[model samples]
Target: MDCLNCFEITARLHMYIDRELNSEEIAIVQEHLEDCPSCECRFHFDMRIKRLVHERCTIQHAPQHLREAVMRLAHAPAGTYAELDPELVKEIKADLKGGG
Candidate 1:
């Protein structure tokens, strides 16, 4: 197997850690990390950071008011939102058109 370059491997490292890559891609990245000291160090560093963040972070549910506001905004008619925030309504319309 041809080892990928650090840039290519690192670009996909997040996907690898997330288990989002296929088996072949994972194997290629693993092989590259085994042969490349610098990339290996970087990979380990990123992994450690992610682990720390995961350990330290706590999921917080949105406050009821915020959730209600979002629900209202999401369900509001275009003209209704225009009266509240014309610019935001325009952006929302654009985003809807762009399939966001």
Candidate 2:
């Protein structure tokens, strides 16, 4: 297979990391990554992000009150979200930290 250019390699990077590429395509991308420092760094960063999200995030149903609060905040004026219950805000912040 011909060596892939940076653009082509990057365009298919997610697929490569997800193991969706055929053997020939994988070999081409692997070769490009080996030769290109910038592309390699980007690939590493993307892989790290994918791993972090997969490991830290979970599938869960949001509570009705929390869902309602979020929907209200979403539709509210940007700076007007202060009307949301402070306790809920604190809970959300704590949950985000715990997940991270």
Best by TM-score: 2
Quick one: how many clashes does candidate 2 have? 0
Q: Give Cα-based local distance difference scores for all models.
A: 0.79, 0.88
Global CA lDDT computed for model 2: 0.88
Q: List the residue pairs that clash in candidate 1.
A: none
lDDT tens readout by residue for model 1, 11-100:
988998889999999999988888999988988998999999998896766545545557887888876742345655566567557764
TM-score of 2: 0.57
Candidate 2 — worst ten consecutive residues by lDDT sum? 77-86
The TM-score values for the models, in the order shown, are 0.56, 0.57
lDDT of 2 by residue, 8-73 (tens): 899999999999999999989988899999999999999999999988896787767678887887
Cα lDDT over the full model 1:
0.79
What TM-score should be assigned to candidate 1?
0.56
Q: Please report how far candidate 2 places residue 41 from its true position, in Å.
A: 0.1
